[model samples]
Target: MERTVYEEETYVGLVVRESKISVNSSLEQDDNQLDFDLKIIAENTGDMLIIASYSNNTMGENEAVNESVDISNLFKANIAFRYFNGMVFSCSVYDFYDQMPLEAKIEFTMTKRISSSVTNKDKWEMFCVFLDETRSTWSDAGMVTTSYSLDQVSCYSEHLTSFSVLMKVTTDNVSVENSETLSLMSTVCV
Candidate 1:
């Protein structure tokens, strides 16, 4: 068996959705637009991770401080999503180092197929898996890689016939090391 370690230093704050118009009709004319309005609500669930490292110092009799360091660790965060039955279609990650009010965003899309009977109030479930870089006996050495998965369920509601979804991952941190230190990985269905 192989041991896979999760990188928690990456954080996903929230997923947001927007609406885009495919077609429109006016006086003897037709047009289309891609627009989205952010909605705020509760009652959704997702997962997140926080990876960090820290150092400790001890005072010695020689009037000097002894420092101790530990390897980076992972912390998991539970996230709630408003919709269910959606998978991670795409993803992008950005990093800002040594900057105040640090922030980043992950944008992805999702789709689900189900019967024509689902509603907004109906609950659904989805799964997301993130893989970190590591070595495996099955492959050669000196390979740095990462990947993630998104799973979603359908809410068969009578009010809606079809649903197309987009997901956004945003984060804000006061402590960041450097910009251009971010990476992204994604999985999509053809």
Candidate 2:
């Protein structure tokens, strides 16, 4: 038996993070542990990656059968990153070729610009979002669009000024594929 294969493109929605930074401070505390948790959201876009696998079979007169299987599919996801400096980073569609059958996850880290006079007391916060396509009407539209309220932060003290933001993304079942099948029939008369 033979099978037909097809590829389809999908679009994912936007992911949003409430807050990217958390801080703790005490007047009389000598030692403290700061916990920073960031939220990440991924949208479902039709433009995901997909792969296909198939096998072929053959039969011989000696009542023996042989089979061969191979992979024959590939897909890519395009992601764009925007920074606070009005700078944008573009990631091209990467092939979803892996040993394990799972989705692809992409992570990004950004460094915050700080002045030399800044000290430890000063606090800094940053966040990031992704967009599918570029928009010409508005600069923000080109971006996946992060909330200002979510990306906002206040400096605790003037001592701390320099900081950086790291963004992580995970996608599930983005790549899909089908397997091929083959059948053989043989007869012998003595």
Specify the poorest-scoring 10-residue window by lDDT in model 2: 25-34
Mind giving the per-residue lDDT tens digits that candidate 1 earns over 1-190? 1112222322212221212111111110011111212111212222211111111112211121111111122111221222222211112111122212212222122223422333344332232222122421111121111222233212111111112221122133312222112211112321
TM-score of each: 0.17, 0.20
**RMSD score of candidate 2 (Å):** 26.6
User: C-alpha displacement of 35 in model 2, angstroms?
Assistant: 22
Segments of candidate 1 deviating more than 4 angstroms: 1-90, 93-103, 107-109, 114-125, 135-190
Q: In lDDT terms, which candidate is top?
A: 2
Model 2, span 1-190: residue lDDT tens: 1222322222111211112122111111011111222111223222222222111112211221111111112121211112233222222221223222222222323222423332343332233333222321112111221222222312111111122121211123232221111111112221
Estimate the overall C-alpha local distance difference test score of candidate 1.
Answer: 0.20
Off by over 4 Å in 2: 1-83, 96-103, 114-125, 132-190
